[model samples]
Target: MSFSPAAAHPRYDALLAEWCDLLRRCQEPGADGAPAPDPEPYGRDLLGRWGESQRKYHTLDHLQAVLDRATELTAYAADPDTVALAAWFHDAVYRPDRSENEERSAHLAERALPEAGVGAGRTAEVARLVRLTVTHDPAGDDHDGEVLCDADLAVLAGDPAAYAAYAAAVRAEYGFVPDDAFRTGRAAVLRQLLDLPALFRTPYGKEQWERTARRNLTTELELLTA
Candidate 1:
């Protein structure tokens, strides 16, 4: 995606520090204990990707929100740092018109994480978690997946105004689509999410967000159809 000056996030420094800290925890020293590569460049690249112009909803602000939510949900994740990393790469390759953005983002994680000195297993887990964003239907026992998915979806539980703004921003991202088509696709998405047995897997998420998110999705779906 192309760079967008206006989409730049205000908390770049804080976000970078967050990324660097997470990366440092995951890094494995080189042969003979050589230090891992600096995490700043990788954090900068990810920040740039999140700020890409074609995005409206998937901006750096969204990234920071997800990161914060993921951190909040770490109590449910078996590997909190890995969940943090997954949060960083989850939408790193977002494109409104592209269906394979999740896979590509996962691939990007697969390639980048190991080079950043993360262990192979953690890198693979990170990529798997990124791909899971496609369905956001993590199995019951998938702790990390549950946290990542819940964090990614926490925006749905926002108050009416924030939720409305989120809907508008999403519409703006797919501006290339005709109004009718966008409504149809967006309605289907809401229905799919609504059809799930449970929207949020973690105990805190279920108690805090599930009902609100369902209400929001139902309202959005009704509006889209109306």
Candidate 2:
């Protein structure tokens, strides 16, 4: 699915609604029988962060893409709700020039989810899942992690035109970097992805995305090096 930059905020409300529903499921009941704290504000905060000027690829469009893929592969996740939460926070603290974005985003999830009434275990799981995006390398048996990691990478499997658009968006995000520096850095990242034994961890992701992802990566690498 292609995303228009103009529609980002409108689309965020739908994603936020889905997140609120998931948050409600993960909520623990209050001792006095009160409902758990609402997560809409937190969702809005995250959406706002994703809409920042420094972000071009890691916008609401990217979040929605990952969330949609996670929902489609929900049957493969051990905890779909946690995976969904992780998706919301995965790029929450993005900075195109920064290396610690994943760690920072995970920290944000750790700090925010529990206060909003998510259980400790679930909160930890969400943070862990967010951190896994730093490598996109989940353990073989970690189903939820696999699902989340694959979802984050699902854009690699898009059609050629969509993949081209994604590459342009990413380049735009790093517009601060000089052409030579950007090419070297971007090429290194693509090569690392190419070197991975498998790009998609979950069976569903492997079946649906692996080949196309490799093709897209190879195509981009050629353009970068050419």
Candidate 3:
């Protein structure tokens, strides 16, 4: 079902307002004299997508959390607005059973951002940031991408109760898969994260989240393997 404002997320209104302001700032006057596109419809569409029935973890709350973290790390971002926009659309096309969710979400950003008046260069940057979430491995020089990726992963460093809830929500999202298969797949993903040279790319992220994230991932991996 589509998201209705009244029944939708608690943060939906604030997020919509924030997007509207961001899009308005990014809008360029049309060459043909067409009015600048409205951000309200675009924001509403994204909220509806995030509010879809199948999404248990990739909801507005997750988006808000990422945006909050991105805001906190704005000093490290080349383009803070682009990072925030990327966070908005990174999981916009989520499908728990699909491996191409990040790619599809990036494509969605490419298609929709221009219509919302985001410039071509900035839109491409946003799409690149969204795609980077697939591996959470931004290029060494990509400051904005690193911030966005780290923000998206900040939940891994949350306190134990919050981390447990995050895990539960993820499991709920993949409820279509059998428990045995889900556990196996999840453990593999955790192991891969643990095997990474660094769980977070930015100095801020490394200092603030790396150790806690590794601890949480190791603990969860053990449970999954057990």
Error of 1 at 16 (Å): 0.9
lDDT of 1 at 154: 99
Give the alpha carbon lDDT tens digit for every residue of 87-140 in model 3. 989999988888999999999999998887778999998888898998888789
Better of 1 and 2 by lDDT: 1
Answer with 2 or 3, whichever has the higher TM-score. 3
lDDT of 1 by residue, 106-203 (tens): 99999999889998999999999999999999999999999999999999999999999999999999999999999999999999999989999999
Tell me each candidate's TM-score: 0.96, 0.93, 0.96
Clashes of each: 0, 0, 0
Judge candidate 3 at residue 185 and give its lDDT.
93
lDDT per residue (tens digit) for residues 92-114 in model 2: 99898889999999999899988
Superposed model 3: Cα runs more than 4 Å off: 1-7
Each model's lDDT: 0.92, 0.88, 0.88
lDDT of 2: 0.88
Model 3 whole-model lDDT (C-alpha atoms): 0.88
- Give the poorly placed runs of model 1, Cα more than 4 Å off: 1-8
